[model samples]
Target: MEISFVRIDDRLIHGQVATIWTKTSKCNRIMACSDEVAKDDLRKTLLLQVAPPEIKAYVLTIDKAIDAYKNPKYDSFKTLFLFTNPKDVVRMVKAGVPIKSVNVGGMCYKEGKIQITSAVSVSEEDIDAFKTLNEKGIELELRQVASENKVSLMSRLDSLKLI
Candidate 1:
């Protein structure tokens, strides 16, 4: 399977994704891997509906996504993986999904989370997961759109911690 892009955006299939990132990634399929989102039928339908017409999209559990990635039938798939949180991405990586990099996108501020970038915020668990990804040599970049320059998420986190 060719991983065209991997993004962590809380709003899994929003306007920016359906209109911008999908085209930028050049992926034929988009898999939103999140156990919580997978269980919500309404949310799944909404996400699937927003996907661009030419590209297929699936809201799947992390395990199901791993299975699909390993399945020979999907070997020709050029996939763009989407996640709502760093923990889910960590799960996919631990399950042997060969993700080389992750784009940290719009992670909106919520209670108990510290703002990392204007568009991103991190909880303690998120920080730990990000650190793990960094330690594993995976590139973690922050970019709201395809046109913007990529910023190192770890560097931003480190600078924030120092402040």
Candidate 2:
């Protein structure tokens, strides 16, 4: 499987992702890699249901995703990998997923989370996970839509003294 794009968007498989990113990356498959979501049948079903009919979608755990990615049957697939948080991205990379860069799309505001951008908010744990990914040379970019300019997430964190 060719991972055409990797994005950390809390709202997985949303409008921008379903249309813009999928088309921009030319992905045939959309893989929402989240252990928590995979176990929730309702969320998993909902996510799959929202995917554009022309594109296939899967809600998978990190390990299952790794297995699927390595499997020969999926060798021809161009997949857009989506995660809900930075730690999952870190886990996938540490487990040998060849993720060179990640788009921080929409990490929504929550109690105790610092707002990084208008659409993104991060907690201490999130910052640590992002720091780990940055240390491993993963480029983290912040962009809502394909038409907008991508900003460096790590740089923003650094400016805010979060990392």
lDDT of 2 by residue, 28-69 (tens): 999999999999999999899989999999999999998898
lDDT per residue, candidate 1, 1-163, as tens digits? 8999999999999899999998898999999999999999999999999999999999999999999999999988899999999999999899998899999998989999998788998899999999989888999999999999999999898888722
lDDT of 1: 0.93
- Candidate 1 TM-score, C-alpha based: 0.97
Q: Each model's TM-score?
A: 0.97, 0.97
Model 2, position 19: C-alpha lDDT score: 84
- Model 1, residue 74: displacement in angstroms? 0.3
Clashes per candidate (backbone, < 3 Å): 0, 0
- Deviation of model 2 at 154, angstroms: 0.8
Residue 12, candidate 2: Cα error in Å is 0.4
What C-alpha lDDT values do all the predictions have? 0.93, 0.93
